[model samples]
Target: MSTRAITGDQWVVLRVPISGEGVTAEVAAFAARRQLRYDLGDDGTLRITDPESARVIVTVRWKTLPPQVPRTLGFQLPSAAAVDVLIDPGPGLAAGRIAAALHDALSGRALAYTDGELEGIRAAMPLLERYSAARPAFDNWALIFRDHYLEHSTGFVLAMERAGIPAEWIFALDKGDRTWNRERVHATFQARGYRSDVLDNTAVNLPHAHGDELARVGADIDAFLDAAHTAGRRVLVVDDGGLLARGYGAIGAPRTADAALELTVSGIKRIAAAGPLAIPVLNLARSQVKSRLGYREIADSCMRRLQALLPDRKLIGRQVLLLGYGTLGSRLAAQLRGLGCRVVVVDSDLPALIDAAESGFTTYRTAGQALAATSPFIVVGTTGERALSDADLDLLPDGLVLAPFATRDFCALTENAVHRGGASDIPGVGMRFALDRGRRVTLLGNGRSMNLFEADSIPNEGYDAYRAGTFIAAASLCADPGRVPAGLHTAPADDAIAEAGLWSAYYDLYAAQGKGAVRPPTVPAPRLADLPAPVPF
Candidate 1:
């Protein structure tokens, strides 16, 4: 927690003479701003870098209170850096605090990682934040998931849910999500088995405002309003308030509640009073209710969808770095390990490292340590910070930095990370892969699947196909999930539709003939094997 680091994992910068500008000083200064702790007390050697990303471009033996046997060590400080890396600090710092510190360390500062270095680290922040976030609220309502995970901490409510009551569970939503989240519904249901026919009541009993119905309901609306006024009606729904005239004729109920919890208040209290009723109404807008509910089905569906989209990355003789070990990272690790990847998880949060460790993830507190040991197969950032630094960029290995949360800062950090002491100029291309009918079958029998595998060969219940399709869909959204890669690209909507259509065709193509479905396209025969192997280059 207190930045107490273990060593042997040092970014050894290959030394050049220090005559002009003490590069070490610059490095030290940059690090100091980030509040990195280090002391340059050695045999004219300074070692600097986080445990995960430092390269030791040149390794020199530094003498700390004690001297070592090797008068010198051979390694170079890494100049190659990714924009994002995991940080490890004592229990004192929150993720937000650390991010602010790093931003100040580099922005408008001197002795910072080279311009190239800064860009690379910034590139991966948003992605890391995503990974660093607590478990996401489940939204995929169509699948099964663990119920307790999506619960909103209420015993009475949870009890009703587990009892299979036809209870309509709802939650207030001022916390910014607009759509009804399926995960919340599913989780609650899973925890408490309910014979619930889930419905979206936010738009209850009214024509959609955008459709022609709103206009149609308009002129008739005023007539209802006039009738209510003439009847001397006053809206009322209370147990005791002495006798008073109550409004009986109203055209429609209020469309939306002013606040989330208020939505369930009035109607729900009445329903609850009807002890042991079959159709129970749980008021979600009762102020203290959670903003969103969690549900098992939603969780399962999301998990499945995510698992489907995730590429089964393998270590199989490759080096790799896993930036953040929060929920996303945990899932990613499990999947990758299944694919035979050697994973090492890094995080600034001690609890995170502990979680990963307990879960059997190779946990690390710093990027510098991971870098000192080996170049990774891939560098995946999950924390929501610009973790990489100029010093880090100057020493990266030749590999890909997969950012699950790519943003402008993330792109810039990675784009400008110092490679070989300077900014990288090798711009990458954004490419897409689809199961284009091949003369012969393959991931790219003309096009690679978004799962990064060929169609049939792509494992995991056609997840690759779905991913491929989503790439096209993402492209259509002009939403570059990552940097505007320089090469080929898999657009979002186009690819998503293709994958969807393919799956539909695979199952229903034959049904078009007024019967059961027929098999769509079969994997081509092996006879065309000599036809150029889908242009891997």
Candidate 2:
């Protein structure tokens, strides 16, 4: 029997021992089979682009050296027949599948791992294993609503089941999901005993859609609740908060969740805006584990994606204006500074600004002040709220590139009446708009989280510990829904997460283990104000 291995969101790099011509033909066949397009650059770089989105899904580079030259390209030059296959990083098994096809076509030695090495190279989930051993019996059925089709998400659901949480039904919003994540989710659920629904028109501003779209999502939730109730099992909502915000507050609705775990800060805000909640809601967004540990990974992804999207622009010694000094923003500022970029931060919150200043970043009270003083080449928005107003767009430097880590950061520009109509699409990149006096500013993504815009932002292993924390919190909340009161609970969730011994598991699993294994320093993260802002319009 082949060994099953655990993995994360990553790109697969395969080196094939075939001639350049042979590999190129195989790649062409691969693209033609999928109805994809390809571009062969002058520098022996072959790119496979998606037909619909115009995004590069795969890249192939050839390595060749003369017979007389003794220089090796990192390995023994076996007659110069090696071409590196770079499968784009995504959320599903598609990359692996593509790699397998190419490997087989070229009759090359094993370079694809997931499909090739079905056994070995798998990392064990220590925290999940420990929690599963405890046998936290969750009697009720669960309405698992999260980003669907992600490999890690599938792993998360499987982990939940392993930890004794029964998922009655699964729901995923039909937006911003990677193609493979959707395919993997559908295939996984179909094979398993659970029914999953990809709710259309529920990705953003749900229940507020007024017509068919709203009705469809509402009916789906109603059906899930009814089924769980008929089975004499209370429904526990494991959400990113979209479904909970949409259905949990329906007046005279069929039923409500017994307990809920809200994941993202956006979800927490949505749940609050939708009126009073009557069930115990564990605030995983504000938990110490997520805020302190998870945000760092998220920030890292943001920076990585920014660099990937703008491959030609040099990051070192660049002038950057960073909007928002919250958890994600602060971390991004520090990282940008570390990369030798002169990073200036802006925030409405006084304490956050003070913290940024003390952290050695140039800080400002508002974005306008920062814009007036510095002409930045890149403007990064980490504020989950509106970072730039429509009028403020005029003040931006000519040829400025806006990289939004949050969805609503550049909404003012993207949604502006004039700019929206006049904007031109820069395929593979984002939208480019002409501002006043011939100044041009480009949005690096579709005004969504740039890191997640057609890209897997964080690695699966990078966030495994936090996912474990969420699971621990969910298990605790679902085990006894009434143990805590019916409001957003953060500290208690953090307590439960801390007790799960995730740090130890993480250290053992990821960090180097030796005689002198140094434990990370315990520094309490600065508390951000819990004041709720209105959901981005």
- Model 2, 1-537: lDDT tens per residue? 112211224445655545678767877887898788878889878777778877665566666423432111111213334455555422345544554455454432322212111111012223443454325446555555555345456556666665555544544444444322354345445445666666532345534545676667668777877777787777767776676667573344457877788888877877877777777888888888888788989999899989989999998999999998898998888899999999998989999899989988888888888898888999999876778886687689889999988768898887677888999988767899888898889999888787876665675556667777887887777767778887788987888876766666567545757866633221121111221111110
Worst 10 residues of 2 by lDDT: 113-122
Whole-model Cα lDDT of every candidate shown, in order: 0.31, 0.66
Scored by lDDT, the top model is 2
**Each candidate's TM vs. the true structure?**
0.26, 0.71
lDDT for each residue of candidate 1 in 1-537, tens digit (9 for 90 to 100): 124222223222222222213444544675666555444434454443444544232222322222212111111123222122222222222433443343333222322223232222222111111111121111111110111111121222232222222232222111111112233333333333332222222112222532353343332333433443354321111111000001111113222111001122222332333232211111222211111111122223323433443347434555557777654456666665665667888888898889889988777777767766766755655443555554554445543444332121133243332321232222121212111122110111111111111111111112222222222232222222233322112232234344434334323432355545443223221122221111100
**Which regions of candidate 1 are displaced past 4 Å?**
1-257, 260-317, 405-537
Q: In model 1, where is the ten-residue run with the lowest total lDDT?
A: 238-247
Prediction 1 global C-alpha lDDT: 0.31
